[model samples]
Target: MDTVADRVKHLRKQLKLTQTTLGQCAGGISKQAVSQWERGITEPQWEALNALQRACGVNPYWLLHGTAPMLESEHTPSADATPVGPSPPGHPGTCPLAELLDDLSRRLAAADPAVRDEVTRLVLRYLENPPAGARIAKAIELLLGEDENLPPA
Candidate 1:
């Protein structure tokens, strides 16, 4: 990400946390403060940054200067290592649907209330209709905007 705001938003998304949730995890800060940080309206103070690092395993240097890894190296899994045993309860590996729902919730939390309601209605409608194959692909393209390189549905 190019800016601290981008990095902060990316970190929250990676953790599947809403702004309020992230704030809570980062030591009980308010959602408005998190929103301001994400919007580039104000930088997080040293105390908040330290709390984020301690509570969320964020790399403070990365959060501040953006020159290092986003997460502490010890908390991040090595790319080459395969997980050996059963995932812990509530872990993303143990419940992919839960993880996805958490991500959706995080996004919805950032949206305007009206937009959130509309999106929920649309999703419910789509679930009922359950578009298939080419229709699904077309819908995805419509939502994401067309990508020329995408194979035809």
Candidate 2:
């Protein structure tokens, strides 16, 4: 009997998110709340589910029923759907944020579990209360650092 709890767990793993991180993405929910849901002790309320959908792009119906596909179909958008706007005037390299995120994601995917957990903690802390100016730059540098002992690529 596959339940919502099972689906939640599966989706979290598929996205490589820790329970706490998943909670944070889902409108500042608590790790315990995610734990309980995964344990089938309780379920997410409607608002939380909506937040989860926005955070992870999961299909809400799929999350609930385990029936439809986990993601919305690409071809299903209405003809009147808003077209993508142009990039900012000074924006460089076309979608810099997306490129950086993709790089970080690939690095994280290749990281060992313990290192991944530590990196995840650092990221969550930064997200929770991001620093200003140069601090943000430094934080990103540190987050992307490799262990000093590793040989140069």
Candidate 3:
């Protein structure tokens, strides 16, 4: 428990995942790959690191350099915190778009970790230059086609 292997093992346990499950969560890495990492026999590739970040909300800086908290803090207000100043014009819960993004994040968080990771990447790409609201609605409709395999309306 002296190197990155230790940290990886620690995080995996924190998430209550077995080696095989951790591998699956980390971008479909092989179980052998996770074993090797835990044994310090080999290091994780960049993709694995990125996958870990998305799947576990790990702080990449901490994962790589061990400089900060393991999980990235979004400064989410705690239940006991009281508001001081006026809320921002487009703060989450106020703006429809922010609410949509928040809902998407919450829903994705409940998905299979590998799928969540993939969707996170897609959402980040969409955020780079977001389209018109109608375009986003269409995109989401296409993404969430009917379970009955019905075509988009």
Candidate 4:
């Protein structure tokens, strides 16, 4: 990627995460914040970059400097041992919610922009102040339609 904005957008796409999902992965940042980063309107703060590193195994150095090896695992130290961050839980080197978020992102990709925006806002709200489990299930059903593949609520 030529710029930090390009890198951020590429990383988000590589992770198959929507802007909202990526923001959530990066410590509950807003979708608008992610958008601004991708659009080169603003750069990510150090804390957000660190959270992205933890959330998605991004090499923070490469992310900022456009160096080689986009992923943390691909980098090798020439001198002192680099401090390693903890692997994300659920699956090795991945955000716990990645799969669910990817699926949701794909499902919403073809949605009307306004509809998608509204859903994203609702999701962010629910995340901030979570509702009952049944309420969450109902909201998902209402937004994405019933899916036989979804497990029992």
Candidate 5:
């Protein structure tokens, strides 16, 4: 997972935004301060983080941890269903996140650009749903905990 600093840097590059421009989007946050945040010399305050999220049109959580794809075009999953509670009882799935990611990878690996978009929409739909109940929830939580390098929320 990319840290917040890494994500911020990536976002700036992709958007062709200078520190000055990013600070402007962040509501008067100074260019020097933005540079510091990007360089990992300092962290942004919660308000500043939110401002950056709004400016970049990204989920604050995802921006911090790089858990999800950077663009809507990169998501994948099934249509008409977010991630439900879990796979059926006999289904050997461990983590829904893992399964979803694997499925997306397989589909994307096989798909042409023309048909890949619908897959992206499906992933976005499932990204919003948290796991249900302790059985799956605990496993997912512990799995996430293993990601200690993920940027702090």
Candidate 6:
């Protein structure tokens, strides 16, 4: 069996990905750092191990010990597609308005990643500590059928 070093190195190579590319996916690694890790000069930090598993869809245990299969049945959901903080109210399929909002967000994201990212950040911030009258104001706007800057209802 290959050592952890060789396994990681081989996996990166088998995907035809440069060390630099793997490093980028690992969040804050550099090619030289990856080279050192692959040569068994050092081991990755716990955080780095998590990042690698997340980025490459490999099992962390396999990456470290090669004792298990590389593929993991469970995977983390994509950042953009997953919700944050808490789940929205009511059953998912029952709310047409919520479904529309999700679909709109997806469409806006497809149109522009940068704008959508900024908008998402803004929305998350606004949601974190919603102003006193924000919900009422939104409700009034919706009742009045004003499109404005809001997503679909």
Best by lDDT: 4
TM-scores of the models, in the given order? 0.47, 0.48, 0.47, 0.51, 0.45, 0.46
Candidate 2 vs. true structure, TM-score: 0.48
Q: Per-residue alpha-carbon lDDT of model 1 for 56-108, expressed as tens digits? A: 77866577667657877545546553322223234544322233334445556
**Cα error of candidate 4 at position 66, Å:** 0.6
* lDDT against true structure, model 4: 0.66
Best by TM-score: 4
Candidates' RMSD to native? 15.4, 12.2, 10.5, 12.3, 16.1, 12.5
lDDT of 6 at 115: 52
- Against the reference, the lDDT scores of all candidates come to 0.61, 0.62, 0.59, 0.66, 0.56, 0.56
Least accurate stretch of 10 residues (summed lDDT) in model 4?
Answer: 82-91
Cα-based lDDT at residue 53, candidate 4: 69
Model 3, global lDDT = 0.59
**Tens digits of lDDT, candidate 6, 1-153:** 478789878778866789899887776899998898889897665446556666676555567667446755454435453232222233342222234345344445444566555545444443334342245324433333433444442
User: Clashing residue pairs in candidate 5, if any?
Assistant: 75-120
| lDDT of candidate 3 at residue 5, scale 0 to 100 | 83
lDDT of 5 by residue, 1-153 (tens): 357788878877888999999888766789999899898888555445446655565444466556666743455544643343344345653444434344345545556564455545443433434433334434433333322333444
Q: State candidate 6's TM-score.
A: 0.46
Of candidates 5 and 2, the better by lDDT:
2
Cα displacement (angstroms), candidate 4, residue 124, comes to: 29
38 Cα displacement, candidate 2 (Å): 0.3
